[model samples]
Target: MIEMINIGLPDAIAYRIEGKITEKEMKTVLAIFRKKIKKNEKLIIYQEVVSIGGVEFNAMIEKWKFFLAFGLSHFSRIAVVTHKKWIHKLVDLEGKLFKSIEMRGFSKEEKDQAIEFLS
Candidate 1:
């Protein structure tokens, strides 16, 4: 499941993700991104991963397709807050792949710092 979090930022959106991610939920997220992109607003994303069960195969594919087609350029920053050590390492590595977007990982305890980084 994924739930939107209102952080009171016009150019930023946040989500709390848990459990398995389905294609339907992935579409919902992509819809929001499409809207933001249409407005010509580069985005800052704050994702608080409470718990990840697994991603549906379709959902993973959909996410990759969307990002490949339209998302990469529209993102300015990404802050991932999670307690998982592997997630932190993965985020750090992926951050290097995108020169235009600044990606950072924060411990769950440093959620405030994550928001500050987005700001």
Candidate 2:
């Protein structure tokens, strides 16, 4: 599941994620990104990932569509707050794939730092 977190900034996109992500959920997220892009909103995403098992098969397709539509490079910065080491490493590794966006992983205890970093 994904939910928007309001950090008192229109362009600052913060979301909380839990359990398995479904295709329907991804579709909604993709739509949100599209709308933001249309409005010329430069985005910075802060994701709180917890107990992420896996995304549904159809969700992968939606993800690919998003990657194609936006190249996953629309965001200028991305901060991931998580307790999972693997999740942190995965995001950091994926950051290399997109040069336009800066990706950083912050421990759960360092959420304030993450917000500061993104700002």
For model 1, the stretches where C-alpha displacement exceeds 4 angstroms are: none
lDDT of 1 by residue, 44-106 (tens): 899999899899999989899987888588899999999998999999999998878899999
Clashes per model (N, Cα, C within 3 A): 0, 0
Q: Can you write out model 2's per-residue Cα lDDT over 1-119, one digit (the tens) per residue?
A: 87767866566777888988989888888788888888887778888888787889999999897888777556888999999999889888888877778989999999998898888
lDDT of 2 at 97: 78
List per-prediction Cα lDDT, in the order shown: 0.90, 0.84
Candidate that scores best on lDDT: 1
Candidate 2, 114: how far from true, in Å? 0.9
- Candidate 2 residue pairs that clash: none
